[model samples]
Target: MYYAILAYHEEAAVESWTKEEDAALMTELLEINDRLVHEKSLGPAARLGSTQRAVTLRGKGAGMITDGPFAETKEQLLGFYVVDFPTLEAAVEAARDLRRVNPTAVYEIRPISLYVPGTPLTARDED
Candidate 1:
């Protein structure tokens, strides 16, 4: 089965990291990512951009588009990973590995009921 691992962290705290600090952490994470790739346990993963540039569309009809993430929680969704694991324990283990490297972040794991590999993202307008 495939699982979605959503990564969350305090946006402000993450933003405060020095370039070298961030790069070092990413390098470590990428190392683990590479191992998972070789094991064929990893699928697509992405590092989300800052919330300052985010937008939310609400409602079922002509949804209102608003600037920035509006969640009032302390942590913000920072990134995500899609991986195939045989059991929930296996998925949790993968998340644990990620947490070990980035102690401050939180990982939310959920079984994916439906997923489509969607077309490669192309053209977008810049305002």
Candidate 2:
């Protein structure tokens, strides 16, 4: 099964960290990523750009175009990882490991559903 790990953190708090602190955190994250890579469970992973560059589109018919994210939450989505694991327990364990490295961030794990072209959406299952 494939799980999507969503990372959320306070942008302001991250930006306020000292250069050395930031570097140390990055180093730890790199080490964790290396381990995931070696285990062959890591798929695609990336840190998103600042929310300032984000655009929100809502409604129908041309939609109302707006700048920035849709919500003004204290914590914003900062990054994500797609990991393949045999069981939900394994996926949750992976998320827990990531939480150890990035103590300040919250991780959300969700299973990915397979999408097939030209097939009814209702026909798809976790398989």
Candidate 3:
């Protein structure tokens, strides 16, 4: 199975979204999910809230626990999608679909690593 992560930020008109707008967007995503399901390509998807409600923890022994993100960023991670696709082309297509609805926002596509337990690290990607 392959997975991709899709995220957006402040560019979305979330604050201006009305009930009707929310319904329409949900409908659009539902349609996409339907297509994926038909092709047996669906996995997990989620939409997250703003980072204003975030909490952060720091330090190792008896460290500080703070109420908010660890770092300040203009754009916060808005959501993610994990889908099973035949190839990277399919994953890019999914990202394109997302970008259509959120024109001003950005979508990042990344593959997940499936590392086995008790295995030494080979190469780690920078966060």
Residue pairs clashing in model 2 are: none
| lDDT by residue for model 2 (1-127), tens | 7789899999888888899998998898878878889999888889888888999899899999899886667899989988888988898898898889778899889988645589766643454
After superposition on all C-alphas, the RMSD of every candidate to the true structure, in Å, is: 7.8, 3.2, 4.3
* Runs in model 1 lying further than 4 Å from the true structure: 117-127
Expressed as tens digits, the lDDT of each residue in 48-79 for candidate 1 is: 99999999899888999999878879999999
Which sections of candidate 3 miss by over 4 Å? 70-72, 114-127
Model 2 segments more than 4 A misplaced: 114-124
| Model 1 worst lDDT window (10 residues) | 118-127
Distance from true location, Cα of 4 in model 3, Å:
2.1
How do all the candidates rank in terms of lDDT, highest first?
Answer: 1, 2, 3
- Point to the candidate with the largest TM-score: 1
Number of the top candidate by lDDT? 1
- Model 1 clashes, total count: 0
